[model samples]
Target: MAEVFIGSEEVAAGRVTRHELRRWYAPVYRGVYARKDIELSLRDRAIAAWLASGRKGVVAGVAASGLHGAPWVDPDVPIELVGVRIRPQHGLVPRADRIASDEITRVGGLPVTSRVRTAFDMGRHLERTDALVRLDALMWNQKFNRADVRALGDRYPRAAGLRRLLELLPLVDGGADSPRESRIRLWLLDAGLPQPETQIPVLATSTRPVAWLDMGWRDYKVAVEYDGDHHRKDRKQYVKDIARLRMLEALGWIVIRVIAEDKPSDVIARVEEALIRRGCSVEVDDLHRFARTFAA
Candidate 1:
């Protein structure tokens, strides 16, 4: 990808006039510009924000998470920067807070929060569901160790969101593959179900593993999977998913599948039914609490 150059650089090169810059380039930042045809991706926006900071800021929050290889962040999510000392723009959030040098790193020549710092920052600053989704994506994509985040938390003893970060630290599971998967796991736990293991390998008689369940109870041979739209839209993925579910069913495993429209209550009911069919005793009162929790 061609780098989005600053307007000053183009002016210095004498390749463009003020009118040309105004007409041909789209202003991504106050003074930074990109080719009008270029799609403003997450990376592009981050670069624009860095340029707007005079190249002296560290990307943080969801923007930094995307730079660290997390896949769930939206491309248009505000470009957040720390140590920038700049006024916030329409799509830029500049924080004038102190960020230790150890918490910053470089990715694709742009300054960003270190992987652990990004995870910790998101966990502390975002709402519970959003924070878990970002943290889960970071862990899944980068294989980041949870211990690093815990240790980093010690450095920011009085951070604004420290309490929430500490609360989510124990719940961060690297095994989840997507944001929805993480949300489903949280819902299950809040519903008082036994914590299901994620990305578990389903092995047949042969040494090789046949498939992996999104989340499951090994003891009861029950599995739960959240199927997003892509699983149905992508022809090959849809076929493979069908074959995989059939194999698991043939192997005596009960699979509970969730989709975008599935309500939390419906999901809990389906999983509870599966658990009962597997000969597990599920408490009716606990199930009622699950419904209440969802209602809340």
Candidate 2:
């Protein structure tokens, strides 16, 4: 039987030979050589290398997302790494910031760029959306609030996503169960639609004083919703969705439905049209790419 994890003995004894290693199927990271069933993209390789190198690194930026269980972040994504104090001889240092005694820690047994120390290490170094997504996911899913992210950022003012996160973090709601909510919110924002409070109380005289709607517009009595495929396939959910829509209508709320393809633009147009008919005369303009910087 063979062991899954490799150690220094294998490296020294030549037990890790090219001929023997090639027979295995998992994707191998070059140089530092970590393997898992999933393919390691460039960013993955870099961070993995840094991690395997004897407690010398902590992965940050979009690349650290895999550890946090974010859906999918590009593996080659360039982020920052900070390690134990050493000389310039260890060239794996990407964005090297020499840390004083107070700034760094070994979180969960791995040498990590401290949550506060990350800004000085990697915050200002990523793309706008990538940076924002990481911040949002960390706060919402990881349960960090803007203040925690900031106090950490305050220690390292030049971090990658700090200022942008401070501005946008208020918008990240931990309650969203899927990416659909994010896409819908972003589309509506771009279209100049009034920001609808999500999971809001839809109130009217009824058996129940108030009920939650996925997305709601107050003045216009209109609601926008995303029906994930599970709702269609699950018989109980299908029935419940129909009943909910009918209930909202009876309760004086108009519901507009949205799906995946409705993304990028059509979602914006449909929402705008529905809102216009509701008596808000906001101009409907074409949704065009501004700079086309990053892929959603």
Candidate 3:
């Protein structure tokens, strides 16, 4: 089969011989196999992990996020599962967390954590920055009520990382287009600046929206934009961005453009200066502390 399957089961069912499996399929786990010619995606790997668990585990965390159609998931990330007690392998992580029946749902006939449950698990289990990034991506794909996840936390009052999860809930915004944008937003918030709105729309003469700012204060007309390499690499996008920036400036918008090489402190300073120039006051001492922590 082109898809991931249990090699021994296929052999037992007379679907394929042991020699055929060995020649045409590559082992993904202890007994899981996929066609050698096919490229395995994150879902395939997740399914393989489930098969490795003998179909007993429910996929969770980033794996579940990916299965729910969230973008930007690293295909190589280890698949996380709940409700299984299998020994750890190269690409599978088995967790013993308490998962409720409502928290699990079937995607493509595979049991995966529901969107809210996946977000909850991710926020509690992953590092803060990574958790926010994944949460933004997941929320961007699937609209879920934060209160639902909070209720889950209330149910598991003493769950590990519950406090951290509560703290992170307020920062979760689905409008972020990229992880870098989310990071920049976090930096501004940590610097004691106002929480800038994401994907702020600037309208043209007509009712149609002309451009969307990455993150900005609408009242102050100040925006922070993270420019990835693709903006410069793609000639068409570069030309379009130049035109877009000019239009935004004409509309009295102060855009702070950030690139990969820019230091975090410099980016924050630029944004802070722009906001201040646009009549938004920020605490300089608090910002300096944040900058130092970011630099460290």
Task: Choose the strongest candidate by TM-score.
Answer: 3
The candidate scoring highest on lDDT is 3
Report the backbone clash tally of model 3. 0
lDDT of 1 at 32: 86
Tell me the tens digit of each residue's lDDT in model 2 across 12-69: 7886766555555333322344444556554445444464444466665444544444
Give one digit per residue, the lDDT tens place, for model 3 in 71-163.
999887899999989999898999989899999999988899999999999999999888999999998997889999999998999889989
The TM-score measured for candidate 2 stands at 0.65
Worst 10 residues of 2 by lDDT: 287-296
Candidate 1 structure quality by residue, lDDT tens digits, 175-249: 888888998888877676777899989999997889888998999999999899999999999999999889999
Per-prediction TM-score: 0.89, 0.65, 0.94
lDDT scores in order: 0.85, 0.56, 0.89
Candidate 1 whole-model C-alpha lDDT, 0 to 1: 0.85
Record all residue pairs in model 2 with backbone atoms less than 3 Å apart, i.e. clashing: 43-75, 43-76, 119-159, 123-159, 123-160, 123-161, 124-159, 124-160
Pairs with steric clashes in candidate 1: none
> Lowest-scoring 10 consecutive residues by lDDT in candidate 3?
287-296
- Name the Cα RMSD for model 1: 2.8
Which regions of candidate 1 deviate over 4 angstroms? 1-3, 233-243, 276-291
lDDT of model number 3: 0.89
TM match of model 1 to true structure: 0.89
